[model samples]
Target: MAHHPITHGRAGLNRRTILATGLLGTMAGFTHRPAAASETPPFRYEVTRSDTEWKARLTPAEYRILREGGTELPASSPLWQEDRDGTYCCRGCDLLIYSAAWKVSVPKGWAFFRHSERDAVLTGIDGPVPSYGMSPDDDTTMIEAHCRRCGSHLGHVLLVEGSVLHCINGTSLRFTPA
Candidate 1:
């Protein structure tokens, strides 16, 4: 029996190779347009802007965590200590997503909210992000929250006591006085 480089025992596509190819193609579908001021990519969100505009609007730190999906150090957000009456809006699109009244302090070092405005936030099945606190098992997945208007990466929603806990990053939010 001779084995070819492209195939294994049966000389056909292997499960691993097919799965890998499918995974790569699926991941590629999530790619956004290039980072430039011109050439606005079509987005479902009402608010759309060029990468350059986003960069100019956001600070370097905010750009990384919000646009690039980078995580901030735990307990490093000034909003961590925020205990005022206000609304929490998306730093990317100024969309009012969370209410200050729903803020809950947890030891996890991120802003925890019990709820958000009905239409202000959207959710999706989070992809494989190492630090996203999702179990590797497909049965136990993580839910990601975002600004419905701008598609900004807010954070993940974890289930606690059978209730939803929106664990949002402080860098992804801005507070406004009520």
Candidate 2:
């Protein structure tokens, strides 16, 4: 008896070859591609300042969080313990962003708020930015909240327990008693 190779019809492709080609094509379709740059212009804020002016106006920690988009260590800011009736303002421009009524206590250690004052913040998708305490290889995306007036980095908007949480960095805010 003669042994014969099993082949699919006209192309003479074997079962193993067809399966491997199909898997390779499927994997190629799933490969990650960086998003294309938007054609629209960048947003212009109500207040603008030079880098030198911003550095001079803000403290080292405040500058890091507000200008450089850096995150403070969890529970490191005194604002986390602030429970007084007051308003939270942007450390960069002193613009009121969050009201005391919107504040909520959460286990995340950051100053969590149910929401910001209307039109106080501008939110956009943060795509794996390493300056925001994410690793360079991290692919996680987050909703970044910025002060609408000064365009300073305030914090991130996250969903927690079916609620929208404005998880702000305390250093990015200045609390004023009402």
- Listed in order, each prediction's TM-score against the native is 0.67, 0.69
List, residue by residue over 1-66, the lDDT tens digit for candidate 2: 122333223224533565767765655575474422332356689899999999999888888899
Clashes of each: 0, 0
Model 1: per-residue Cα lDDT over 1-178, one tens digit each: 1234444433245446657677656655766735332333545679888899999999999999878777789888988778799999899988889999899877778889998988988888766544544555654567888889998889888976567899889999999878
Best-performing candidate as measured by lDDT: 2
Evaluate model 1: give its TM-score: 0.67
Best by TM-score: 2
The global C-alpha lDDT for each of the candidates, from Candidate 1 onward, is 0.80, 0.83
